[model samples]
Structures are given as structure tokens and as C-alpha cells.
Target: MRRLSETEVRAAVRGGVSRDGEISRPLENDATAIKCFGCGQMEYRAREVCRCGYYLRGQLEAERQRNADDYLSRERNRFNQLRKRRNISLVAFILALFLGGLYVTGNLTMIGDTLARYAFLVSVVFVFGSLKIIRELERQMVELSKRLN
Candidate 1:
């Protein structure tokens, strides 16, 4: 309901005659006037819903449901992306471990060059892939904390 100042309420209480000789009754606070969320325009508020032309019947409930659905869809997409990144990081890290073990245990005179080359490639992949995963995880953590607050 609209909250009118005391002055406006008093003025309305004192009825007046318009130029057309029509009597004006005092206005009631039954429905409030508010700005529409979708269009940012003024409209009457009824039953906790804005009577803006943009929405249909039961508009407020529909809008809330729509927002909830959108949030769920976005969260699912984010989880899928994170899963892919995690898998890539895990594989690269495992390869790095295997290559490092071979380098440390293999006989230098027998497979030194081959082990060294594979070790370098593994280290490069492991470092870059892990970094990417770490960055994405940190970003997601920040977003989660923000939503919590």
C-alpha cells in the first residue's frame, strides 16, 4: 500500500470541487505505487505483486521460479566445466609423477636422453595444467563466498 505523508492524507480528507463541478473523494491506501522491476516504470502494487504490463497473472511467483531455474542451470554448467578441468589436471599430474620416477630410477647410460626429454614434457604439462585448475578453483571459491554473504 502507498504510504502518503500526513499532509497529503489531510488534504485528500478535505474534499474539493473540481472545475467540472465533480466532487473528489479522499484517496485510500489500498494499493501502493511502486517501480516495476522489469521495466523500471511506476505501477500499482497489489497482493505483493507489481501490476506492470510486462508480467501476466501470478507474475511475482513466476518471476521467482524463473530466477531459481536459471540459477540451477548455470550451476550445472559450471560444475561440468570444472569436472573437465579437474580430469585434465589429474592426468597431467599423474604423467608428471611417472616421468619423474623413471628419471630418478633408470640407468643414466641406457635411457638418459629419452627419460630427460619425457621428463621435460611432463613437467611443462603438469605445471601449466595445474596452474589453470588452481586459478579456476580460486575464482569459484570467491564466487561461492560472495553468495554466502
Candidate 2:
């Protein structure tokens, strides 16, 4: 594409069309028939006042902004989800510790034979499951932080 001088851009914007009065066939039916003074190409949209290269540059900038917004939104959502999961895991770990303490302190004997036997096993399951989840979330959080830099 040809390089448009500052004066040409200003003229195209101010004058509303090229000095040659060349009306593009596709844009002739539209209200304003302003072509890009720089490249001499008609506006892509009916309301567009500038030439093709400038319009395309504006479009590219908009696309880049949209992509950046999308990336930030995705990262925020992922971080929120990870935080929620970590909180749940932490709660589970605390409950498991409490239960295990009760079993170790012989408090399970008060609950009787059948229930006492399963308390330790359930506590063990909770501890391991919470640890696994916490480890995985920590790894993901690290990875996510790395991407931000």
C-alpha cells in the first residue's frame, strides 16, 4: 500500500472524499462516496470515511484488544476456580485432621465398635484426597503465575 502523507490523511478526513471525485461502484449507492485518499480504495463499510489501509489498521487494533481482553478474562476465571477449589481442599484437610485426632485420642471408642472402625479410614481418605487436590492446585497456580510474566 502507498504511504499517506499527514496532509493527505487530514484532507481525506476533512474533504470527505478524494479530490478526483472517483466513486467506487460498490459504494456509489451509499450516502457518502469518500474513498481513501491514501490508497484510493473505497471505504469497506457504508459509514466509513477513510481509505482501506487505515480502516484495516483500525480493525487489526480492535481485534488485538479483543484478544487481550479474552486472555485476561480466561486467566481471571481460572484463578477464581483454583482459589475456590483450594479453599474446599483446605476445609477438607482441617476436618480430616480433627477426625484423625479424635481417633488417635481414643475418642472413637465412645462412638462404639462399628462406627469407630470406619472413622480412621474415612479420615485417612479425606487427608489424602485433600492433599492431592492442594498439590494439584498449587502446581496450576504456579503455572498460571508464570504465564502472566
Candidate 3:
């Protein structure tokens, strides 16, 4: 199949309907239509704006913003959530490093050795947990990038 011309592709993404041998993307109330990230189709659905898995997630955020006032309140909530996750992973990595150091010290009694082992275990858990969060953030970043395109 022939590749769609740039004009045709742009039209299609803008949610154009074909007519008179030309595709035209329509906007509501004659408003300028924003490009959709998902399916390259322009849609008014705030949730439909993203072409990525996070489109609905963006919608949810929009909803939250619409209902809320006060930048401090909104930013605080966002920062707290981000910080909590970051701290979890940070603590885990630090614990792991500390345990590794203890193991290297090689001066532990039986109980100390057991404690070090447990610390190491906890560290492993945190590392895995941090990785999970990173993966999620990566997914979101990718979706945002599509919008930029």
C-alpha cells in the first residue's frame, strides 16, 4: 500500500472525515483541535487525547485539576506521592548497601550475621519495589512523548 501523504496523515490524525476528495478534521464550536496522541485521531474527550495507555490517566488528572483549586494543595499532593515512592526505593538501596558493607566487615556474631541477612533481604525487596515504580514512570513518560510528537 502507498504511504499516506503528509497532508493525509495529518488530516487523519486530526479526526478528519473524508469528503470532496479531501480529509478535514473538525473542531467543536470552531475551536482549534488539539492533536490526539492515541490513534492520531483528534477527539474532544479529554481522556481520549492520549494515544498511549495513559490517555485515561491524563483524563483522570484533568478531572482532578478541574475540581481542585490552589496550586499549593495540588502540588503538595503530587509531591507527597512522588516523595513517598522515592523514599521507599532510596531506603531500600541504602539498606542493601549497608548490609553489603556489614557482610564485607566480616566481624558479625551469629545474631549479627542473621540481622545482616535480614537487612539484605529487606534491601532486595525495596530494590524490586523501586524498579516497579520506575517502570510505571517510564510508561507514563513514553505516553507523554507520543503527545509531543
Candidate 4:
């Protein structure tokens, strides 16, 4: 079989009729064209596969599935990491609350009054910061889960 010249290929892509005089089906508006994924060349959409042997339907679907699987795996890892961090932050927030409560109730009396007050204030700040971080991480995990679904 003779290979088509570039001009001939372009003409066929542009809806030129074959020897049988049958008009090619247009892929887009008024143009019957397909771009080859392997070599980045134009071809008629009626062809089953590109000249470079990239099966249009099957290989394209496989590629899309691979991409989706990769994306989901990355997102799942990220979600797991976020869950771990959120658990850590929850533990920190609880510890900060416990220490702050002890200081406030005078149960931790070894420290000076001013130092205890400062420590309690610092613990309060830590608790709020941890809460903010946990909230943000939870929001992110929720968004990731939605995407995964």
C-alpha cells in the first residue's frame, strides 16, 4: 500500500472524499479530523487507530484509567496523612486543655503565680491553634474524599 503524502493526509482530514466518493464523518464542526496521540499528526477520525499503532479507543481508555488510578492513590495517601496529623493535633489540644485547667484551678502550684499564668495563656493559644489546624485539615480531608468519590 502506498503511504499518503502530508498534503493528501491533510486533505483527507479536511473532509476530502475517498475514491468511493463517500464523505467522511466530521469529528468537529465542519471538519472530519483526528489528531494522532503517538506522533501528533492529523488523521481522519474514521481510522480505527493511528499509523503509529496507538489504538484509539482501547489504549486511550487504558491511559485514562491509569491516570485516574494514580490520582486517586495520591489523594488517598494525602487523606491518610491528614488524618494522622488531625489525630496528633487533637491529642495536643486535649493536653493543652488539661494543663491549662490544672493551672487555672491551682492544682499545679510548683510554678510561680506569674509563670503559671503565662503558661496557662500559652496553653490557651496552643489549644486554639491546634483547633484551627485540625479544622483546616478536616476540611481538606473532606474535600479530598469528595473528589475520590
Candidate 5:
């Protein structure tokens, strides 16, 4: 059986509609009135089983568990992506540092002085860019960790 939407469920509890698309006798609006998730039938909240033998409590618990599982999987995927990006940024930062150091010490002599200066400038830019990316990824990971906890 198809599940009812929230509005439809409320209407069902209010005796607004029936499965045959006919107006049913309106039920008294009480705190205990609720619609069953299994058969989409009006039922009392205090009752555990509906007329169709569907256990409301069990269905509710199962739905909650499914939602929690989905949330955890999504968060885990996001965390893994962030970790990969952070790792790539860290590697880039280290490489840029090494290149900049080589240029500064004049250890890379095959390149002309002007080319070496340009290379150093590019490496400096890469270093700062990588640092910024790493910081942002760290912040995101921290936020994900907080949410998970």
C-alpha cells in the first residue's frame, strides 16, 4: 500500500477522506487520533496494532533507523572527499615549498635567473593557495565531526 503524505494523514485522522474517495463520518478531534503508517487507516495513538495488524511502534522505529543510517552514510562520504582534497593540498604545499627553497638557494641552475624568479613566484602562489585550501578543508572536516558527534 502507498504511504500517505503528512497532509493526507492529517485529513485521514480528521475523517476527511476514505479509500473509496468518499466523505467518511468525521471523527472527534482528540490528542489520541493518529493515522497508521502501514494501511493509512485512522487509529488511536494509544493503540500499538492497527486493525490490519500493523505494528505502529515497530514501523516508527524502523523509519528512524533508516533515516539515521542514510545520514551517517552521507556524512561519511563527505568526510572522505574532504580528506582526499586535504591530502592533495598537503602534497602540493610540500612540493611548492621544496621548489621555492631550491630557487632561493640557486640550486636549480639550469633555468635562467629571470625564469628562476618567475618559478619562485609561481611556487609562492601555489604555496599560499594550497595552505588556504588545506585550512578550508580542515574547517569543513571539523564541522562534519561535530555534526557526527
Candidate 6:
């Protein structure tokens, strides 16, 4: 279920593959060794990464699945947090709107213009919360990449 490089795969096809290939013995090799998605650590050969660790697509895949799971978990957490914040902000925004509406419909004191200001504030708060979640997810991505290195 792993993706492998053409060479390693060719080796496996040619029966030139190592016994490790049969037993699914993950080579100490990195991303260059096999196509296992579960691979980590960049592979290198003769001072170059070309033939390095096999870039285990198998292991990398597994790791990615795990990372994806973790990411989902984190996303759930962030979603909850943002939902709570948004609920509170939305309530405040609604209250602001109500007041603005009352002023507009009623007489002067002309606070109608304040409605735009309140709306701007609410939007900013929501945007900031969303960006925070995005930033967190990106950080997770970077850490996952390191596992394969």
C-alpha cells in the first residue's frame, strides 16, 4: 500500500529487491529505499540524497495517516475553541446591531454610523480566530515533514 520510487520498485519487480522487500523489512534507507508511504528520513547515496532512505512511501503514508489523524484531532479542538469565541462575538455583534437598528429607526442622537464600526470590529475578531487555527495547522504540517527527514 506504499508508493515507491521507480528504481526500488523496479528492483522489486526484477526480483533484485532485497529479502526486506518480501518480509516488508523496512530498509534503514530513507525516502529513496522504497515507495512505502510510511517512510521517513531522507535517503542519500554517495553523499547525495538520490538513493538515500528509500523515501519509504509506505512508512511515510502511515506517518501521514497518523499525522492526519493528529491534525484532525487538533482541528477539532481548534474548531471548538473558535466556535465558542464566535458565539460570544456574534452575540455581541447582534446586540450592537440591535442598538444600531433602534437608533436608526428612532430619532436623532444619530448613532447609526456606529453600526459600521461595530461590524468592522466583529469581522476583525472572526478573521483573527480563523487565522490562528490556520497557523496551528501549518505548524503541524512542518513537524510531520520532519519525521521523514
Identify the leading candidate in terms of lDDT.
5
User: What is the RMSD of candidate 1?
Assistant: 10.5
Report the lDDT tens digits of candidate 5 across residue range 56-93.
77765776799999999999999999999999999999
What's the lDDT for all of these models? 0.58, 0.73, 0.57, 0.78, 0.81, 0.52
Q: Candidate 1 vs candidate 4: which has greater TM-score?
A: 4
Worst 10 residues of 4 by lDDT: 19-28
- Candidate 3, lDDT over the whole model: 0.57
Better of 2 and 3 by lDDT: 2
Give the per-residue lDDT of model 6 (tens digit) for 42-67: 23222322234343445556767998
- Model 2 residue runs over 4 Å out of place are 1-54
Of candidates 4 and 3, the better by TM-score: 4
Q: After superposing candidate 5, which stretches have Cα over 4 Å from the reference?
A: 1-19, 22-49
Which regions of candidate 3 deviate over 4 angstroms?
1-76, 107-112, 134-149
Best of the candidates, TM-score: 5
Candidate 6 weakest ten by summed lDDT: 41-50
Q: TM-scores of the models, in the given order?
A: 0.47, 0.63, 0.34, 0.65, 0.69, 0.31
Order of quality (lDDT): 5, 4, 2, 1, 3, 6
Comparing 3 and 6 on TM-score, the stronger one: 3
TM-score of candidate 5 to 2 decimals: 0.69
**What tens-digit string does per-residue lDDT give for candidate 3 at 1-149?**
45677887777666554423434444533344444545555444434434444364565567568766565465556555656665676666666666656656764334576786776666667667767875675565455445434
Q: Give candidate 4 regions above 4 Å deviation.
A: 1-48, 52-54
What residue runs in model 6 are displaced by over 4 Å at the alpha carbon?
Answer: 1-65, 105-149
